[model samples]
Target: MSSNEEEKLLSYNGEVLIFQLSQGDLAKEGTAKTCRLRVRRMTFNRSTSTFIQKSTGIFSMHGEYSGFEMICCSCAADFRTGINLPCVVIRRNKKKSVFKYFLLLLHSSNEFEQRMNFTLDYEMKDDIKILNGPSILWRHNRTSFYISSQNDTIVSAPVEFSSIKWAGEVENLGTILFGVGEPHSTNRESSERSSKSDYAVWGTEFYAYSVESQKILSGSYFLPHAYGSVVTCIHICATKVVNTVLRISLIALTQKNQLIWFQDGIPKNLCQLPFQDPCALQVMASDGGDLLYIVSFRSSDVCAIWKKNFQVASKWQKVKSVLVDDFVGTGTEQLLLDFKDTFNTDCLTSFKITDLVDVNYSNDAFDPMENDLFEHNLQENYSLTVQALERRLQIGLTNIQELQKHLLLKERVLSKSCKALVGLVQGKAYIPPYEEKDILVSLCGEKKQLPHSLKEKSSDTYHDSEHVIEKMWYRVLEDHLVVGVEIKNSFLSFLNDVTLSLLMDQVCTSNPPIIQCKNSVIKLDKVSFPATLSSPCETESVAKRIKLTLHNKERKNSFHDQSSDANCIQVFTVVTALSPLLAFHNFCCIVMLHARWGENSGRFGETCTVPCGKLSLSIEDISSGKYSVTLPEKNKPLKEPMEDLCTLLAVFHKFCFQITSPDCTLTSVKIWLLRHMECETVKEFPDSFLCKSLGALNGTLFSWKQKSPFEGILTVY
Candidate 1:
């Protein structure tokens, strides 16, 4: 959406913003079945109900024309479609207007939300019309929306907007305003009752009114309008806006009753539009004064092409409604005509804005406060509360800005100090006395989270061309990597020209680092690029995979031949260091295994050196675990009730439990297979060849061939 080409709708006078509706591809012939294409989208938007005059954000949101997203959703069916609509965004667009593509957003009349702490970097000099953030321009990304000044357009009497005055809690910010009744009788008999200063009682949202249009007033409210404010410019909120703010899902009316709302018995003007719910009901303005912008909720992109398709010379005739449904008992054509009339610019002239310098809301309150002081009270000295609070606010704001500047300066100094420290440490530690700025850059910042874990980020991209074979068992004691080749092409059973290479994606060698591969080893004082790790070309063979499965019909064992899968796999592992433990350095390493497959290609297959994909492992995995790891496999099949008993105090401190099979196996380890450390200690392990979830022994086995002779389960809680 190119907002750079701006053409506002509300800003202009007579210019109508014609929305261009995109046509759906569900094309059908004349004999096709008719179905309604209605879509309802709901998003939970939580907002703090605070009314402080903090900055309200208003940023430009764009539609599909500018920032369309591809949706690959799955339900009963795999539906891969391109929905031409904008995503629900929190920030503004960088290059286009918010409404550039279309206004597909749920517009709320409670629009002034002071949430985001941001500034527009400009001075405001008005009663503040635009929300304090990036401007939400009413721009059409497709066909530029049309606009006309009030000069060339004819101005008619604006819709009458009789502003209401309230008392009590909700005097300032009127929470709920009902206008579903006719104006009170203006006769002399009812003059005192129908006067503007009369009290307007409020009711609960679920209140049941009597025939007299009155309900038992309940609840207390503190109106934000307590400070008093006159309507500056009365502009009717769009239907979508009002429904969204009020969260009105449904609005049904009977034949006898018209959709009229009342504020203190004052009738409100509204368009007679047929809709499924309140969301489609138009909140019409009764009157207006000068020409101003109209807040339109409908986006220009998906609106009907209703730009006076017929001749404008003939009384501006209303076209037959193209709606798919009827309105009440009458045709929808007339209702649609009334809907367009709601946006008529001719009603701008009646928008008269008047200020209430001094308002007496005594009679308007259900319980009006009595005036206790006389005129002399105004002459006495008093405490200025709001002024003092404002001063305190100024001090806090001043401190925040000053502290932020100071932090920025200190951050710069810290960066310089880190570099100097890295230089000094390298000179003292390096054996060859080399200089590598990038290597030592990580001296100050090393990943501490997920100490030694590394894994692939995304699914493997290489399909049948997988040539990298991992050697994990060789380093199984120190490494946790357990993955193999995923090959599909079974015919090519051998890999040739295999080259095992290593590349350090990260280096934190403030201390000299050592690199080891196979029988080769090298200690480096500094780091360089394109390092080698066992760069010897070798060959590996793949075999056909076979799986045993029971025949569904025969109930007998059957062999399922997986010809595409490779059974024999070549594995490899890489350690970050040659220390006592595994990789402990906060670093990233990319292992590139290049190999050639299939050489007899004269007529069968081609011998090509294909990339086996690059695997970049980094110690960047973080785990913000909230709780300790639960008992390994306990409760997997539901918790087992422990049955322990102590016979007597004579043999106290001795707990006993009868074990039938213990559901474990006692496997003996060969003496020659044990390491020097393992041989020195007792290698007596518990029943290890058994499911721990089932049961272990007096204590379950933890590690295989360990020095610790006893095994115990340490439950956290």
Candidate 2:
């Protein structure tokens, strides 16, 4: 019905006059036989102006007794013809006892009743209100309800309440919220919550209570998810039956286009269906009995639509999978219960073709004359057929090949990028090679710490001038080695010339010669050198003996004294230091000495020393320790602003680094100040640079603070 008509029905919120009459008595209107009618006046929407349609007969009363009859009434639209309202007649039964009357009537405070336990019988009047008990108002797709109550004051409140008696068993359930208005506005308040997309589910429970003391009466959990699963195919079976039973039947096409029944839930397995080429399916119910319809195309020459009785599903031996086209279109076809239907190669068995033929050409008028017409028809028929055949033969191979090629290209790009990154990290191109330079060579040796198997052999004993041997050893002194390197060009020049040249310049540029006194020897023609070295610096007051040791003493000694006094003459030389400039060299200058021959003169005649350079150094120990700078008191004179700021920055940097650094060691800050001195490159950092650095540090510090594991216990301020 239209909204106007529905609104008119709702406006009649007043007493409703319901009457029950019999059909037999109403047919004899002219006769003296009066039908008994039971009339009960209950409140209804007084504003309604539409004709009321009810399924059951109404009840009312005759002159003196209750009569059941059909009443005839004329409507404005059909005024000329007589239309009747089917009703029943009711009368008072006086013989029934008071106790029996009391047992039949039940009342509540919300209801308007003239009398319930009175001695006299009650009669219906125009303005007198009677309780309607309960009823349903509206229903919809998701939520539905049946309002139930013991009584309703229809005269004033006029609330249409639902009664349990009106609500039949689940099998006899009907629509309840059919005409209900939208509960309230469901406008979204904000975009964030709107994205959630909230939707209403079915609420099965409904009750009537005072606004002050609301209480839950009766409720049930409704399955809304199940309803949403197959919303498009919802069907309501309205035919009534004696016993209520909900029989549901579902017919659906599987992902593989196979016909299947959704027996328990959704069809999850395709093997359960018999048909391999299903076309369409539908579901229907009558008298609480459900049926499934399935259509299938079996090869190009056959098609059928089959009906399966859902009530007999368990008893079915072999459900027929029907192919529909054979019986639908005009063709030279044959019907069979078992593989009998067939069509020619013209595709007369396709349901789509049959439907097209039915819609375009209702009558059989075969034309075989025009060539253009035949070509057009042939093109229409063969286009889809050839395309389908080609697609099946290719089987999506082109798409699969394209995807593989895309993945291969991605892998190649990733591999190339990874290799480039590795090369960059290992100093492949950015770091220039170190240029070779002349370095002073001084070999200083000490006694070997190895077992007897690796000891050095004794030199040949000869009565030679001890003071003379020391003079020949001057070439192996540490100072002479430094002077030699200063003269020759080395790869270290490039290291000192690079961007970080200042760090390399920190090492002492030059050193004085190292004087070697007492007995010592030198060998310039040796092929191999020793591993251990011993040498005395200039600070040592007394001259000591130089020792020579070998890894394998069983072999011949590789050293030879240059002169008879080689052991006596003092030797002066220089050795390369462990500075970054000379860090790349693989050789170390060393000085050697021999065992003393007497208290003043050295023994064992002569000795030599050799030392090799180490490849790497670690600064882990240098970064940890307590470091502090004591400032003069406030009363005392102040230092330059740059000096103060530098000291503060250095201290702060060390502390912040400790907190943020992954490899920081915990130590007092004061020790750090003692080890490294701050050189004032400038008086102070410019305000811009200082502010930028401070901001960056502050942001980093804040991030670290937020993520700190000991956030609450430790404060950064």
Candidate 3:
């Protein structure tokens, strides 16, 4: 037996897509039916109370000709897997007691084609909760949810992808957001002790399966004591994320018109709602994030509104909330509304709502998920190409004379280029960056800028060393540091009797800055080589100095101070005997300072230029109190683009990550790239950090790092 095959797929546009099916009386051949899918603009209406269904789209199959009988029609979608969409499931009965089903999705709203079809083996029973786009993970009365092998009717999941958790039953299933889950209830014994004991009862006794995550989140929001658990329903005005964790602000309404907010599954006094039930039938936030609009029914047929300012005095006050009825509704009608301020008023002044009772949805519209910018990555750019030789006849003198009549029609475009068109047809414009995957044929030189601090430090380290910087690749190769001399006169004299000494750490020579410096590798791995570069590395000892001390806050102990000072870089600068008496380290780049074996102070010729590594840094932390810069709230077990980023680093021996926090908080950092090593105690505010080479980093860099998918732990306290 096989059921639920993808016979059609639908693409969701901004409008809501509705599916309605009607099976007519059976004829000699078969029963007549219509699977109608339509598009409806589910928005708010102020003028009209009665709703009308417009002819947006119509996709239906009439007059069945086959022997299959329509069993039932339902909707199902597993957003965590391949596609996040509500696919229509159609069951059927074939000859000889055989069973089959079809899964249909809109082909594409943009494409004028039929819907897509997918079929899965095993028959599914109805009366199971599938409303709101969730499906039960069982067949033939809660039977086994697993299959041993892949057949023509079903595909097998990957071995590693198989989950070990049980696909247990969800008692009293209600809402279907990501997966099926047991309805909320106030049944904890602690609830008898205290009305709020339900808050402490965090359990995973509901749906253990999810398409959104490998391990379903282990938390649920049960109704508080005030809200009864008698299968009551409430309208969800809006929702908000509480933090980086999946915890959210569940703002919902009650039959008592109580506008409540549940933070992390508990009702909190987030804001003051007016005694008149807030008059917030619909709640929405402003684009600026400083104001909110609340719409509610003031009277039997009158609408009222209020504004809550968050940035200013932070008070709830009345706004333009007047609209008409609050029109009466049908059993199937849905009211959608939006807040708008056409005028440049500080607060919202207008609201529009409408009733979409008989609208439709189908895969016949453009795919919002495919064409989205952030959620679903937009499609890659593609262009048609052809050889210049193939188009030689089309570009000949004969074609120029034929285009004379249409020349005037082409002027409508503001700017047009014939060369671009020619390139498009000839395929010359789409030249790839690489000539061949394994070969390179082009050559070019670009002017590169070296850090000025290196030259300045060289002058301060050695009195006789020259301040001039030569074009050099300091640590281009494995374990080898190369220095090029401009071969100038004043520079040659400085190298003479210079005793070299390496300070190992601090970069500033004028005076020790208030901020301190520490060096440590961010992550340590014993690999043969890194992906970007391939060569035998001699500084494996440097890596050996640092153990795998991950910055895991979940660990019972505190920070690791033993390996706080990891030998990440072995850089030495040119110094002279005349320079200030400085403490040197065990291993450093051999800097040419004035030579003298016994003297504490290096003999300097009154001038030396010490080159330091170029380091760019950007950090953020609070200054007033002792706080820990923390790791981002983990998306447990890990999920994608997030999981993809981890895999990217896992595949390669080394990874360079640009960390970011949603709230934009950071503190101390330690990074050890190929040759240069940088570490320092930094804060987000009050005390700004400055690198020896790149200077003070901009706070905007925090906002800029938002693109990176990786994050690191930070701590200063």
* Best-performing candidate as measured by TM-score: 3
Angstrom error of the Cα, residue 231, model 2: value is 2.2
Off by over 4 Å in 1: 1-389, 428-713
Between candidates 1 and 2, which one is better according to TM-score? 1
A best-first ranking of the candidates according to their lDDT comes to 3, 2, 1
- What C-alpha lDDT do the candidate models reach, one value each? 0.23, 0.25, 0.29
Winner on TM-score (1 vs 3):
3
- In candidate 3, what are the lDDT values of residues 254-349, reduced to their tens digit? 434344455545655323233334333433332233223343544322222223421112222333332222222222322233233444332112
Q: For candidate 2, lDDT tens digit of each residue in 101-197?
A: 1101111122222112222233322111111222211222322322222232111112223221111122333222111111223334532343321
Q: Which segments of candidate 2 are over 4 A away from where they belong?
A: 1-135, 139-168, 171-717
Q: Give a tens-digit lDDT track for model 1, residues 1-717.
A: 122222111100111111111222222442222211112221111121111121222333222223222111111101123221211212222234332111122122213222212222222221211111111111111111111111112111111113211111122222222212112323445645543423121111111111112222211111111111211112122222243232112221212111322222222322221321211122211112111111121221111111112111111123211111111122211111211233333211111111111111111123323221321243342354667878999999999999999998766545544444334333333222244333333322222211111113222223223322322111111122211222223322454443434433335543222234432111111111111111212111111111222322122223122222232222322323222111332333334343444443233322232223333332222111111111234223212111000001111122333221122111122221122112221112121111233332312222122211111221110
Alpha-carbon shift of residue 599 in model 2 (angstroms): 94
How does model 1 score by TM-score?
Answer: 0.17
Give the distance in Å from residue 102's predicted Cα in candidate 2 to where it truly belongs: 28
Query: What TM-score against the true fold does each predicted structure earn?
Result: 0.17, 0.16, 0.25
Sort the candidates on TM-score, descending order. Answer: 3, 1, 2
